[model samples]
Target chain A: MIPALGLLLGVIIGLALQPTVPLWLQPYLPIAVIAALDAVFGGVRAVLDGIFNDKVFVVSFLSNVLVAALIVFLGDKLGVGSQLSTGVVVVLGVRIFSNVASIRRHLFNA
Target chain B: MTQIPQTPEDGRDLDVQPSTRTAWRRLLRAASPRPTKGTLLAGVLAVALGFAIAVQVRQTSNAGLEGLREGDLVRLLDTVNQDNSRLSDEIVRLEVQRDELATSTDLEQARAAAQQRLDALGILAGTTPASGPGIVMTIRDPQAKYTAAMLLDALQELRDAGAEAVQINDGRVGASTWFADGASGAVTMDGRTLSRPFVITAIGDNNTLAAAMEIPGGVSETARRMGGDTTVLIRDTVDITALRPLSTPRYALPENQASPSK
Candidate 1:
């Protein structure tokens, strides 16, 4: 339930920021949203396991933000923003498909 | 016999408690997750907004294109008009300068220099004074399909052959005069309407200028090609001083230089 909530919040952030964001950063906004959702899920899992570390959460959050920004920046500087967006979308799409498939397999395995 | 489990002190089990309606609620909430719902809505709205902006941008760009075309046409016309005005002004200035120089003390010196140049070129300036002994050619072609531009070309050729003074049937050729079709289908010269069978009178050394015109592929030949009538009359001395000088140029040089050459 919490993970679903986090996904909802991230999507809302993406839509709100789309217009204000520059064209170069557009591709990464969706990626950032999804990454944030995953981070929330990871944090929740860590808490349940009684192994939650503040340093790890902060580091992961900061790295995700920086990496997204860097990819967009480099794409813009190389004059390949559109191509980079295509690559990012393909990778994220595949990841989502695999994750969903894994969940489906686990649920039906028994 | 059964044993009851005790609650943990840290409240972990309470946090994970599953109520009777928990599964149904989670499924309902998952089906309409916030991120998915928000993103879908935003994507649809963004597409609509982009469509509207694209339409507006296209319309604005089209308007700008039309405005630029009109501006270019206006600029072209203005440039042509300006050039016409400048040429007229320059002609007037030259005429005034010529008149003033004629009366100056330097006139005699310049005349001597000109005479020397003419002598070197095997030509005499004042020997004949370009008077008498020439054929007057009057060309008239009212029904002919020739244009005024063609007639102007002939006139130019006549002048180049050393015509001292040339006049059309009703208008004297001048610096500012343009030969073009008038509104009524007849040719217009110097803003005056003229009919067919235009008579052109030239006064110069009859033998020399006339012989010059008689050369092959000359004015007579060109007129023949245009199906116009050409008449050349040789006379000992044809007095033709009734022609009026062209109007005072619109822009004359200052009065300081109006003296005739010595």
Candidate 2:
């Protein structure tokens, strides 16, 4: 439930921030911010549920950012940045779908 | 607790079986819900956001395409006009050289040099010198709205037709030249602004080059589709001259001048 709420809030924030951001930073900001916030919310929830490790959370967050940046940088160098980003979005989309499905099961199972 | 039978015929064991079963079922249902509403809502929101982003991206791409097209059209016209002025200047210079050669004491050498220059110019213009075969191709926009790509295609066709040299609106054709738009969508080429009705000239075996250009799906066809006029004529002699030496190239050659020696 908390993850869902966080995702919704992140979407709203992204939509609002896109137009106000600088052109150079605009491409990276909305999606990055949303993903980071979503991860943070999930981490907090896990900690509350007594399943979180600070080390694991920190490592996952750092690796996620590093991988995303590396992919973007390599794509740009290869002249296929847009295509690579699209692929990343597609994978993120599948993950989001599965996450949402699990959240739904948690909220409405009776 | 022992089960107390309320009715013998009904077999009701409310004190034990029924209560235990109800509690267990309730606990099981509480542990697992069939549909999680939170997940459904999040999924829908994400999809909607993705759709919105896709629309915005498409709109931006369309705008860029239009910008590029406008830029190309403006550049093409400008290139033609700039070339015309350059050709006029070259013609003037050649005339002056001819006059000087005619009056000089070293008349024979000067005349020879002048003739050679004239011959070079003639070849560059797609004109025959004295008595040879050359083709003349005149290109103009019929509706006065031709694009840079169309002009480029025509130039490519001329080259493929075995043209030794080509000129447009009197400007010598070179690799560095390209059409681009300037302020307010005006066409500019090589810093010179130009208008429409671009004239192109080519020097070659007039008949052969003309035949090549006339091939099906060739430049002539493309020009026709673009509503541009193309006239190919075989001239007995045509005068063409090289334009003034090109300014410094945009990119410099590598500095390793002695690499081959090693």
Candidate 3:
């Protein structure tokens, strides 16, 4: 409930401000969003399993965003930014899919 | 209870079970986190992540270029660049045309001034008609002393006296006119014969021109000494009605061009 409330507040503020991301950070934002998506799915699954930890959820969210961005940045320096981004997306995609599938089953009791 | 083996060491479970269960429950309570008012940090991080995602989505769609391929973006950039350069070139061309129009108005005024000066010169050279206050000198050369040299000298005197236009015996005297004496005191001016009693018309200041020829030992005196009659009259207006024919230069070119040495 707190996460949902927080998400709503952030969306409202962002819409009102319309702040531009800095140029150096622009390349990482898409990857970070995907990483955040993975973390949200994991958090939802944990909540369903009755083992949700606020500390763990917050730490995981931060590390997911940071590591995803860092990987892309390093790959860019190494001239393989697109390939690394693809790899990261593929892995996060599978995790999010599995988590969603579990959430679906848990909610539907199927 | 039935699955447990009844051994001598396992008999302690019965005695220690309640206390150990309470300790384990205390540890679980301490380790697991529930969302309380103190979970502000987690909420804030979640908020920040949500904000970033929303902003990224907005940025991607704001330009109306969502879902465009990379090649399409490059092509759009090229078309925009071409438009910019074409506009720049058009501005430069218009500026140059504006400058030319501005200077041409000034050039037109200068050309009018030059044309006026040229007309004045044509009058003075006797290639055009002129009317002004001047003196008319009538000469009766019964003694036939108004030779070609004397006629030429008279023209020079009138020129020195500021005569702007001149005619002698119905012939317009120009810069290149010549006099040739014929038989029995007859005169040929510009290949046209003139009978005796020549009338010379000159246009200038009436007082100065009359005084010029009337001066002692002037052209009038020279004429009198040659046994010829000379009469000077100041008039309100004199018309040197004859006009010289303007010739187009055939051999002479503009000075800027190289010419063969004579």
Candidate 4:
């Protein structure tokens, strides 16, 4: 309940503020958001598994966003930024799908 | 039929099954797991994630150029640059024309040129009187020896001497002027008979015209041989005030017309 409320509040604040992204950070924001989504899904599956760890969740969330951004930054320097961004999104998407499937089974058993 | 399998097993299975409400409660319990310290942190992280996603989505939609590659962006910049330069060139050309018109010099120049052309045409068409330094010649023919042809020759000689305007006795020498002998054996110019001592007034360079009349075998010598005498006097200003009426063409048409009238 708290997490859901927090997400709603964040969305409201973002809409109200309408912050403009800087040029240097533009390429990394979307990649970081996808990585954070993957982390959230993994955390939800772990909670359903009865093996949720606060420390592990926090560390994984931060590291996922950072590593994703780093890889894209490196790709930009190597002239392959778009390709690397695609690769990262594809991998994270797969993970989110599998984790959501696990959560579904835990709840529905079907 | 053959003593259907009516064991009490079906009834026992129905009695052991949990109720729908309890099954739903159990699923809810399993789904929540244990709300631990991570819940608060997860809530905070969720906030950050949601905010970032919303902002990124907004930015992408707003600009729509964020996803383009560097090469595509460069090409777009090039196209814009070309358009900017072309428009600027057009603006510069229009500005030069505007400046020229604003100064009013072009208008004045055009008016002056048109006035000059009108004056020249008026003189050429003999619709205007002219005056300048020129010579006047008088022929004294007591025996009536000078014929119309001799007078015509003398007039042609004056024309060759660069005479701009000429008059014989009260008749204006125009493009259509003709000379003929009247029934009384006197020279008639353009149907007007001239009295003895014909006065010819011409507007031109005084020196050139005087020299032309005095040339050997010229009008003066021929006049002396015919029992007549000719005398020339140069003057600073001789006005040829005779003007010809404007004559409209009867058959000719301007070239720009589509067809001529029958």
Candidate 5:
């Protein structure tokens, strides 16, 4: 409950601030966001499955974002940034969809 | 024959089983570590994700000017330079006219001759608006194989057809216009990257232009053979709204005028 309240507070504060991201980091932000989305859905699925470990969740979330951005960065260096970004998005999007499907089943039991 | 039970499942052993879902669930269980209590990690991630999404959305919405790449910036600067040169030339011409009026004993004849020359030069130099019956052609590349060379060929074909003025998409073509290969199988004309389904509008004699382009063994037929489509329409009047900048000659003077060094 406390964590959820903290999350809500953070969201409100972030929205209110409306901070602009730095130009250098703009390219990576998109992949990072998609990775973060995948993690969010996974976290929700874990919570429903009674396996929502704090360490695991934090580690997975950080790893997802980091690995995704890293792949895109390396792709840019190799002159294939868009192709790699698409790959990352495809995998993450599939995972997110599956996790969300499971979450829906858990919620409505349908 | 084996007697099937009333229930969906039969007593006899079957190859297919309904336990695949359970297996998948077990796999999920093995992957996710079970915790005694809910962690703060999920909340933190949720907050970050929300913030990032909001920021990304806003950024994309405001990305019009900022999204231009280095090449686009260079092209923009080039266009600005051209405009600057054109305006300065006009200023110099006006100043020259002022000097002539002040110095000349007969202003009326000189003014009339200067105005006539300016009018004629304006048309030849593409500095004035030209409107007449012309043709509009749509060229579409279904397979991204159309290159800058192909575009040049088409432009030449139109020129050969006596096209006075031509505009492709929004960029106007002048005598010195050239096409360059753009990134990702695209073509760039006059510093602008043209998208698929290039619409070329040319101002000239409608029937002659159409006949020249539609001649057997022509650019249109070649485009069709290359897995592309071409549609040509001869309109009564098409506006040629593009202006070409005129650069003043510095080192080169008229043949009659002697150089300072000489």
Candidate 6:
């Protein structure tokens, strides 16, 4: 319940601010969002397994966002930005899908 | 009882390699229903994730141009270039029209000025008829004693009084008019002989011309002393209809066009 309220507050703040992103940071925002989504799903799965840890959740969320953005930044310098972005999305996408599938299994007992 | 992995102190769950059967047993383990510090931390990360997603969505929609195909972008560029060239062509055409209008106005003004100059020159050269307020004098030389010099003096006095056009009998006075004594002791002007009463008409200010003739020791007095009576009548409109033929110069040439040897 608290996480749901926090997510709603965050959306409201983002909408109210409507901040213009800087040119240099524009390329990393989408990748960071995807990585954050993957971490959130992993946390949910850990919570369902009864092994949720505050330190692990916080560290994993921060590291995921940073590593995803760094990979894309490096790919841009190497002229392989789009290919690397696709790779990152695929990896994070598979993880998110498996975590959601496990969460569904835990909730539904199917 | 199947043991479920728990990482409470150091959070090291990596040491346990759980097989599929054990993972299923761990998934079956009941989660704590009470809110903990880990749940609060997850809530904070959830906020960050939601904010990033919202911002990324906005940025993608704002840069909608990025989603266009290459061919569509090329076509849009082609249309813009065509419009640019067409507008420049219209500007060039309008500029040419403006220049033509400017030159045509200048041409019209030049023509009007040249026509006005021609009219003034015609009147000055004695090749045009002129009418104005002046005096007509009839000199009766009943004694036939009035000489060409006396008549010439009368003409010169009218000129000094600002006469613009002058006519003596049937001849118009011009730049080249001359007076001389004829064979019959009468006055001959430019080879035209005059008889008894000489009528001179001059176009000028009526008051000033009449005063010039009637002044003491002037033309009227001089004529009376020469055994002739002069009659000066001031008229409002004295018309000089006689015109002089324009004679082409025989020996005199315009300085600019004269032969260098000459």
Best by TM-score: 4
TM-score of every prediction relative to native: 0.32, 0.32, 0.40, 0.46, 0.45, 0.42
lDDT of 2: 0.55
Q: Write the per-residue lDDT of candidate 4 for residues B143-197, one digit (tens) a residue.
A: 8889999999999999999988888887778787889988766889878788889
> What CA RMSD would you report for each candidate?
18.1, 22.7, 26.7, 21.4, 23.3, 26.2
For this target, which candidate reaches the highest DockQ against the unseen true structure?
A: 4
Assess each prediction's global lDDT (C-alpha) against the native. 0.54, 0.55, 0.76, 0.81, 0.75, 0.79
Ten-residue stretch with the least lDDT total in model 6 chain A:
A101-110
Give DockQ for candidates 1 onward, in order: 0.07, 0.05, 0.17, 0.25, 0.18, 0.21
CAPRI-wise, candidate 1 is incorrect
Give the DockQ-based CAPRI class for model 3: incorrect
Candidate 3 stretches greater than 4 Å from native:
B1-38, B63-262
* Collision count of model 4: 0
Could you tell which candidate, 3 or 4, scores higher by DockQ?
A: 4
Identify the superior model by DockQ, candidate 4 or candidate 5.
Answer: 4
Which of candidates 3 and 4 reaches a greater lDDT?
Answer: 4
Question: lDDT ranking from best to worst?
Answer: 4, 6, 3, 5, 2, 1
Candidate 2 iRMSD in angstroms: 12.2
What is candidate 6's lDDT per residue for B108-179, written digit by digit as tens?
Answer: 765776778876666667788888898889998888888999888899999999988888987888888999
Cα error, residue A72 of model 3, in Å, equals 1.1
- Tens-place lDDT per residue, model 6, A44-80, is 7786666767789789999999999999999978868
When only the first chain is scored, the TM-scores of the models are 0.55, 0.60, 0.94, 0.97, 0.88, 0.96
Which has the better DockQ: candidate 1, or candidate 2?
A: 1
The candidate that wins on lDDT is: 4
How do the candidates rank by DockQ, highest first?
4, 6, 5, 3, 1, 2
Score chain B of each candidate by TM-score: 0.43, 0.44, 0.55, 0.55, 0.53, 0.56
Indicate the worst ten consecutive residues by lDDT in candidate 2 chain B: B7-16
Question: Candidate 3 at A92: error in angstroms?
Answer: 1.4
